[model samples]
Target: MTIILAHRGSAGTHPENTMESFVAAEQFGADGIELDVHLTLDGDIAVIHDTTVDRTTDGNGRVTDFTMEELKKFKANYHYKHFFKKTARIPSLKEVFEWMKGNNLICNIELKNNELPYEGLEEKVISLIKEYKYEKRIVISSFNHYSLVYIVNNWPEIETAPLYSDLLYKPWEYANSLNSKGIHPKLKSVSDTIIKTTMENGISVRPYTVNKERDIKRLLQINCSAIITDFPEKAVKLKRK
Candidate 1:
C-alpha cells in the first residue's frame, strides 16, 4: 500500500505549517506530514515554507530577520484566514516535536536552506530529533544536497532524501552516492518504471504535491512508497477504497 503524507499538513485546506494544519492532517488519517523548516535569527527552527513571510503571513520580511518570538506574532494564516475562524501561528520545530510525542505519524522535515544556506541547520534539526528521541520517526529532506550529505555523514541514524524538481539521470545512483535512503522528486519527473527501478536499488521514491485523484490512484495501484499531497483526506479515502 502507498503511504499518504500530507504536504505542508493538508495545505489545500489549512494554513500551511501551522500546528492546526498538522493536527488536522493526522486526523485526516495521513501516514505522515511533510513540512519545511528555516532557522530564525534567534537560532530557533521555525516551520514554514518560504524564506519570506510576505506570502504566508501578514508580515513582510525575511524569515531569518525575525526571531522565533517575533515570527510567531504574525498570524501564519494569511493564506487561509478567510476560511479558518481562528488565526494560525507559525510553529517552532520544538513545538511540532512536542506535538509528535502524542501521535504515531511520521514527519518528513525539509530543510529550507537551499536558497539561503542556513548555517548549522542540519545540526539544529538533528539535535531536536535526538532530544525528542524521534530518530526512527523522522525523515530529513532538502533541496540542498550538501545539507543532506552533511546529515548523512554526521548522523547516519537519521534518514535523508534529496529533493529535486528538475530531471536527473539515474537518481537512485545519485542518492546512493549521497548515502540517502530515498528520493523526493517532482511528480512529473517520475514514472512507475523509474519508481520500481529506484526501489529495487534500495531507495524509496516519494513524489511531491500529488493531489489529483487519477494520479493518486495510479500511485496507489503501483504501490509507490508514498506521496506528498495537499489533499490527504481524499488520498487516504482513495487508498482505503
Candidate 2:
C-alpha cells in the first residue's frame, strides 16, 4: 500500500506544523506526518514552512529576524475554520520532538534552506533524534544537497530522502550520489519512465502534493512507495479500495 503521509500535518485542516495539526493527522489515521524546520537567529530550531512569516503567520519579517519568544506572539494562519477556532502559533523543533516521543506517528522532517543555511543543523537534528531515541521512526529530507550529505555522513542510520523539482533532470542520480534511501519529487514532475528508472536503481520514489483521486490512482498504479498530500484522509480512503 502507498503510505499516506500527511503533508504538513493535515495542512488542509489545521495550521501546518503546529501540534494541533500533528495530533489531528494522527487521529485521522495518516501513516506519517511531514513538516519543515528552520533555524532561528538565536540558533533554536522552529517548525515552519517558509523562510519568512508573511504568508503563514501574522508577523512581517524573515523567520531568522525573530527570536522564539518574538515568534510566539505572531498568530499562525488557520486554514480550517470548523476544526479550530483560533490558529496556533509556530512551534519549536524541540517541542515537536517531545510530542513525537508520546505519539505513535512517524515524522518526516524537511530542513528549510532559505534562512541562514543552519550550519551543523544536520548534527544538531540528529542529536535530538538520538536524545529522544526516534532514529528509527524519523526520516530527514532536504532540497539542499549539503544538508542531505551531512545527514547521510553523520547519521547514516537514519533514512534520508532528497527532495527534487522539475527544474532538474535525472534527479535520481543526485539521490543516488548521496546514498539516499528514497527520492521525493513533485507528483507532476515524475513520469512513468522516471518512476521505472528510479525504482530500477533501487531507490524508492515518493511524490508530493498529490491530492486528486485520478492522480493518486495513477501513482499507485505505477507502485509509488508513498504519496504525500494535504488531504491524507482522502488518500487513505482512496487507497483502501
Candidate 3:
C-alpha cells in the first residue's frame, strides 16, 4: 500500500510549515508528514522552507539572521490570509516534536542547508530525535548529499534519504553507496519502471509534490512506498477508495 505524506503539511489547504497545517495533515489521516528545517540565529531549528521569511511571512530577512524569539514575531501565514481566518506562526522543530508525541505519524525532516551551509544542523536534528526518542519514526533527508552522508556515518540508527530533482543514472546504487534507506526524487523523475526497479533492489522511492489525481492513483496502483504531496486529503481519499 502507498502511504501519503503531506507535503509541508497539506500546503495546498493550509499555511506551509505551520503547526496548524501539520495538525491538519494528521487529522486528514495522512500516514506521515514532510517538512523542512533551517537553523535560526540562536541555533534553534526553525521549520520553514525558504532561507528568507519574506515570501512566507511578513518579515523581510534571512531566517539565519533572526533568533527564534524574533522569528516567532512574524506571522507565518502570509500567503493564505484570504483562505484562513486564524494566524499561523513558524514552528520550531522542538515544538513539532512535542506535537508528534500525541500521534504516530512518520516525519520526513528535510534539511534546508544545501545553499546556506548550516553548521551543526545534522547534529541538532539528530539530537532532538534522540531527546524525543523518535528514532524509529523519523527520516532525515537533504539535497546536500554530504549532510545525508554525515548522518549515515554518525547516526546509522536513524534513517536518511537523498532528495534530488535531477535524474541520476542509477539512484538505487547511489542510495546504497550513501547507506540511505530511500530516495525522494522529483515526481517527473519517477516512472513505473523506476519505482519497481528501485524497490526491487531494496530501496524505497518516494516522489515529491505529487498532487495530481491521476499521478496519485498511478503511484498507489503500483504500490509506491509513499508520496509527498500538497494535498494529503485528496490522496488519502484516492488511496482508500
Candidate 4:
C-alpha cells in the first residue's frame, strides 16, 4: 500500500509541528506523520522546522537560541490565530513520542541538522527511540547523509533514510551505500523511471511536500511506496479513488 504521511502533521491546515496538527493528522487517517526536530538550548529535541521559532511561533529567535521552557512560552498557533480557534505550543520530541503511546501510526522523524548541526543529535534521538522501543515504528531521516550514516553506525537496528532535495545519479545505489531502506526526494524529482528503479532495487521512494490532488493521483498510479503531503486527508481520499 502507498502510505500517506502527513507532512509536518497536516501543515497546511494546522500550525505545523504542533501537537494539535499531529492529532489532526491522525484523525485525518494518515498512515504516517513526518516532522522535523532541532536541539534546543536546554538539550530538548524541539519539533519545529526552521532553525528558529520566528515563522511558526509568535517568538522571533532561533530555536537553538531558546531553552525548552522559553520555546514553550510562544504559542504555536500564532500564524493561524484568526483562522483557527484552539492553540498549541511547540512540542518536544519526547512529548511527541509520549503522545504516540496508544497510536500505531508510522512516525518519520527528520533531523534538521543538514546545516547548523547540534552535537550529539543522533544519540539524543536514539535514546528517545530506545526509551519508547519504537524501532519498528520510527524512521529517522535527514538531508545530511552523514547523520543517517551515524545513526546506522551507532544503532544498527534503527531505520534510517536520506532526504535529498535534488535528483541524484542512481539514488537507490546511493541509499544502498549508506545502508538506507528508502529515499525522501523532493516531489519534482520523482518520476515513473525513478520509482521503478527504486522499487526494482528493493528500496522505497517517498517524495516530500506532495499536496496537490493530481500529483497524489499520479504517484499512486505509479505505485510509489508512500507520499509526504501537507494534507493527508485529501491525498488519502484521492488514493481511495
- Give per-model TM-scores: 0.98, 0.92, 0.99, 0.98
lDDT, residue 21, model 3: 96
RMSD after Cα superposition, model 4: 0.8
Clashing pairs in model 4, backbone N/Cα/C closer than 3 A? 52-63
Against the true structure, candidate 2 reaches a TM-score of 0.92
Tens digits of per-residue lDDT for model 4 on 181-209? Answer: 99999988767798888989999888998
Clashing pairs in 1: none
lDDT of 3: 0.94
Candidates 2 and 3: which is better by lDDT? 3
RMSD of each candidate? 0.7, 2.0, 0.6, 0.8
Q: What C-alpha lDDT do the candidate models reach, one value each? A: 0.93, 0.82, 0.94, 0.91
> Best candidate, lDDT-wise?
3
List the candidate 1 regions with Cα displacement exceeding 4 Å: none
Give the higher-TM-score candidate: 3 or 4: 3
Residues 1-241, candidate 3, lDDT per residue (tens digit)? 8989999999999999999999999999999999999999999999999999999998999999999999999989987898887999999999999999999999999999899999999899999999999999999899999999999999899999999998787889999999999999999987789888999999998999899999999999999999999999999999989
In model 3, what are the clashing residue pairs, if there are any?
A: none
Candidate 3 lDDT score at position 219: 94
